[model samples]
Target: MIVKYTKPGRNLIMVPMLILLTGVSSCASRPPSSVLQPVRLVQNESEKITLLAITNRDRESDGKGFGSRWAAKLTYEKYRFSIPSERKSTAIVYPSKNPDPRRQFVVTARKQLLDSELIDDATSAANFDGTVAVFVHGYNYSYQEALFRTAQMAADASTLSPPILFSWPSAASVTGYVTDRDAALYSRGELERLLGALAKDSRVKRIVLFGHSMGGFLSMEAAAQLKLQGRRDVMAKLQIVLAAPDIDVDVFRSQLRDLGHMQTPITLLVSKTDRALTISSVIGGERPRIGRLDIDDPMIR
Candidate 1:
């Protein structure tokens, strides 16, 4: 696969890293096994899609639903399935002739696996390709939302080798902004542990960290934590891509200062016109969020 790069000043932004899909995508909702056909047509299309997830969200309804609070028990789940492109027209994966909420696109998933075995499975998959992509979701996201979002990103891109999700409990409500912020901060240690696990896994060659909104802050903070531990080797093999980060500019600068010189290249994707960020700016004492970056500002320069 050919990778593309765009450099704006010192920052190196990778194109087509995370393709955000908008719609009714759910991790719990999966396509059936009938979608996987016996024939192989296009080599470009994915044969199988798998996402390894690490989460702090509490399980609900006897593990049927995922809650929005941080749990002391760190759980891991592996989701795998074939895409719509891989099979003939099934009511699953591909939308029906007429839109039917009752017949929504479903991608079937394998039985859930727990514990370090999740890491082992991901590492084995990476052994052949030596590449892995780690995705962190923004605030106001439930555990399943984060899972499906990352799944869509990985499947749609078709370029990402393997996708892994690091899900922190986000309260999943607009009213829980303060609570979510605290939770994001608290998740730094687990993020560090996840990153360190991937970095130390000899089978994995490179890691790409992709973060959106509050997840971006967690990504940077986790990187800072790793740096403080003198894990330059891990940083060397990592690439960071942040989109519309809801980070305070001052805090971001301080995190950068703590990081000092970094081996990993961080790409920041921002839009000043984002109305949600505008509200965040107001709530944050009129200080512009890092997502609404001023490129000309010497702080970032």
Candidate 2:
């Protein structure tokens, strides 16, 4: 979502920023560790979900956790969440203090995962299916929010294997659209490295790469990088799913041209009613965004 300021209509650029400003005003982000502080109590009615998170963000100065800054090195951390029994579908509630596990999500456990422990734990979680789901979140996300959101999606899907989250450094601010865009592009190679790591393990037979919003753009970039590099061995085990991706139409066509010869077909989850993408299109001088693609258009068909 690199919003280049153009002269066509200065009015057009303000539209998205206005929306972003209004959006952030209504929903302010909680304190850094507000929802992330570990809750030792495990509720009987709540379901416990564990996941693997891989990130390129800088760790805290004290090395206790991660921050919003970008980093060159990759990190692996394991997390467990307690999903509230009373939680509504598609609703996520972050606690400000004294979380109620039966009514709100809670972080039960978290720790760094060593290289040797990653495979053993990943294999055990995959169980008989040998499938691993990796999620890449879009722009305007903090590391904690990404972790919680990934766990929620995994819980909703009832996935069989452990979910791995690829968290890139995002400014996590409404005004940081360009910063997030650069960070997303910067993390594509790291995403490829994550794939390479999982592909080497014999137990991981299937890898699903799910990216939402701008993260979908990163996913495609990494996929194209692998394709051009002749990484067929890793590509064979990969299945890509892009949900409401904020990718440009012409750029997507170019990427598809490069990826057309691959053995597996890509799954695109598009919607004409995605307002975020509608604004994104307007910001890009009214250029078409793939997420807002009209399937019935004659030229598109």
Candidate 3:
């Protein structure tokens, strides 16, 4: 796919909010997203979408949900979510303390898997063309949110590749812009290791990396890091997709310069009228973010 760059208009500052404030619900009001919500295991097997999760977030001591704290080591696991069969044209339904398997998305199972074991599953579960999709979530996302989101996308998409998620330690709050940014940066080495491991897998032939929002920034940083280390093998098998990336335009340009020529062209999805980006722009010293793109700009050309 083609990577298109766009410039933001001068009116982005009018929205007048911060990229850090989102909803009315506090962290307390929200149900535990990572706790394994009950589901009829045998009967709901058909509705299950399992994810290969690689995270650097510290696991909560209760073993229910993954907290936002960063960890010194990365962990690999597989989580299975049962998609609600009774939903209409709605988004993912997060399971609460008491959830209906037929109406809300529920966490059916969780398993801690070895890194090599995950690679084996990923290699064996590739798409027809040997493509493995890795999803890197954006800012203010908890582990369960990222996990279920990947499952939702997998269930909606046409591809048969098994879903994989690269979850960094996001503070999981609307006010976590700076916190999430630092956490994403700290997890770059972990992401590099995940990509490198997939590249080294003999059975895996192609990899499609998907990043949204701030995760896109982390993705670019890891790619640059890999290039500096001269990991041509990993770069050869990788294809990048950045959707609504929350990256600074100048930073992205510099990252591009560092990456040089890629084996495959990067695909970027951008919008000119994203109000959320306007808030982010104002916060970033009124500098436009990449997501607020205007492709007609001469510099983009």
TM-score of 3: 0.86
How much lDDT does candidate 3 score? 0.73
- For model 1, the superposed segments whose C-alpha errors exceed 4 Å read 1-47, 82-105, 294-301
Question: For model 2, which pairs clash?
Answer: none
C-alpha lDDT of residue 123 in model 1: 64
Q: Output the worst ten-in-a-row residue range by lDDT, candidate 2.
A: 13-22
Stretches > 4 Å off in candidate 3: 5-29, 41-46, 126-128, 273-276, 296-299
Q: lDDT by residue for model 3 over 1-301, one digit each (tens)? A: 2364422222121111112122111355455654554454444544766678989988799876678998888788877777778855425567656677777777777788998889877766534456788888888788877777677767656456567899999998877778988998999999999999889887778788887778889999999999889999999988887766788989988889888888778876666555545656777898878766666667765
Supply candidate 2's per-residue lDDT for 268: 63
| TM-score for all models, in order of appearance | 0.77, 0.86, 0.86
Residue 247 in candidate 2 has what lDDT?
93
Which stretches of model 2 miss by more than 4 angstroms? 1-26, 62-64
Q: Give the TM-score of candidate 1.
A: 0.77
lDDT of 1 at 86: 38
Worst 10 residues of 3 by lDDT: 11-20
lDDT (Cα, tens digit) per residue for candidate 1, span 250-270:
898788787777555567776
